[model samples]
Target: MRIGMIGCGVISQQYLASFDQLPDVQLVAVADLDPARAAAAAEGREGVRALSVDELIADPAVDTILNLTIPAAHADVDLRAIAAGKNVYSEKPFAVTTKEGAEVLVAALAAGVLVGSAPDTVLGTGTQTARAAIDEGLIGSPIAATATMVTPGHERWHPQPDFYYTPGGGPLLDMGPYYLHALVTLLGPVASVIGAASRTRDVRTIGSGPRAGESIPVSTDTHVTGVLVHESGVLSTLVMSFDAVATSAHPIEIHGTEGTLAVPDPNRFSGDVTVHRLGGEGWEPVPTAGGYEEAGRGIGLHDMAVRGPELRASGELGQHALEVMNAVLESAHSGARIEIASHVARPEAVALEDVRAAT
Candidate 1:
């Protein structure tokens, strides 16, 4: 897979670093709204060059587009790449709206091109190991889960945090994908959702960078809590907040009739998975049993590269997660439980392996 990365922002750095380990992927070109940024990213990288967004999208050498653009541009970039008969892998939230996300999927299907999305973090050992235990019935008869993420705000660390407060941004849309994707992997697709949300202020003061002390407008919910009723009859409680200070809660926890599983954060590639059996003394660590060892961001591209349309981090899953999220927000506003119209098969469990060797 020859990749033309369409954004050179902070998130792009992780993907760039991931490329060296992903033998199945070749980042042939990079583009950013800021030409200097794009050029800098390509510098000293053998055979890689910087091009305008247009040039990169049209470049025949690039068969796949790594759409690292902001949430607002996700659908547009994907549509363009699909129109050009190229596969696309986008960042989280898929698109700003459910309609745009659906359109991107329909276009990809019509064009016979592939689409994948972020939060592939679940394909790593951390989440995958827990998934393995669940499948093996270590935690028999899965019943419920709780996922929680809280922060003062991204404005404290991110140099450019404006997008974190916009329409397509916010705690649920920005950070929810990681938790949502993991829940789907551990449980299954959501059947319906009920939600409530709150925003503390209308603006945020940037804490660092050249724009430090600058205030940005807030146009979305900062704290979002919801209950996702999975198709498997499991209930997962989700709390995503940017307004809070901190917490001691595990990132996620899965409960079952026999036992419970402690899942690590889904934002990264790996972590320890612990479980307590029906009569166990305490929570015991589960040995890593599945997923790519020492994996990173672009592993999804490698998965897509090898699996083609059967890739685990698929656009269909992304869109389903997206709809589940938007419906939560809609439920928040309407004070009603929203039924999800879309459903996606749970992604296949990853067998324990080294990604570098697979390529």
Candidate 2:
């Protein structure tokens, strides 16, 4: 599959690094609102052209669009790519709103194009190994889960951190995708959500980059906590915060009738998956049993190329996750439980294999 990458920002570098490792996909073109950024990405690569966003989307040689644009532009870019008769794989959060996310899916279906989304990190060894252990009954009948992500703030490091404080870029919307997607992958679709949120300050001072010493206003919640009641009757508790410094808690922990499983960070591609049995003394490492070994960002696009419509990191799942998150925020302010209108079947498990073998 020939890919046309539409954003040349921080995350694009990760995808570019993995393109050579993925045998099923190749980068042919790149685009950005800034022509200089696009040119920089295409510089050292062969057979890659820097083009305007419209020209790249309409290019006949490009079969798929790898959308790395910001949250607000995700749906718009995807719709345009679908109109151009190309598949689309976008970054996390799907879109700023569920209504927009649904529009992208409806249009893609009508156009006979595939729509995929990120946080495919779940397809990596960390989450997949934990999944295999659960399926193997190491955790017995799954009962509940807890997912936690916390950081003091992103302004300390990110060059341009204004978006992190905006409405579509809160802790829940910004960092929730990785944890929520992983939870759904381990548990199932969320049936209902109840949430409570808080923000510490109205203005944040940038600590790094050219924007250092600049103050950005915070218009969104910085600390978010919620309960996701899965359709399978499993209860997954979530805590995502930009207000806290750090925590010793595992990124995710699943408890069952017989034991508990500690899952690695879903934002990453690989880590140690450990299990503590009911009769066991200490946490034992679960052997790597599934997913793409040594994979990275573009592995999801590679999976899309090989599996076509059955791609696991699907927009359906992304949309469901987005809806769940938006509902959580709504519930936070409304003081009521919100029911999810969208659902997605659990993706097929990927058998463990070399990254290049996906071809």
lDDT of each: 0.95, 0.93
Tell me, what's the RMSD of every candidate? 0.8, 0.9
Please give me the total number of clashing residue pairs in predicted model 2.
0
Estimate the TM-score for candidate 2: 0.99
In candidate 1, where is summed lDDT lowest over 10 consecutive residues? 350-359
lDDT of 1 by residue, 1-359 (tens): 99999999999899888899897789999999999999999999999999999999999999999999999999999999999999999999899999999999999999999999998999999999999999999999999999999999999999999999998899999999999999999998999999999999998999999999999999999999999999999999999999999989889999999999999999988999999888989989999999999999999999999999999999999999999999999999999999999989999999999988855
Off by over 4 Å in 2: 357-359
**Cα lDDT for residue 135, candidate 2:** 82
Q: What are the clashing pairs of model 1?
A: none
Pairs that collide in candidate 2 are none
Best by lDDT: 1
lDDT digits (tens) for residues 121-217 of candidate 2? 9999898888888888888999999999999999999988888899789888898999988888888789999999999999999999998999999
Residue 230 of model 1, lDDT score? 97
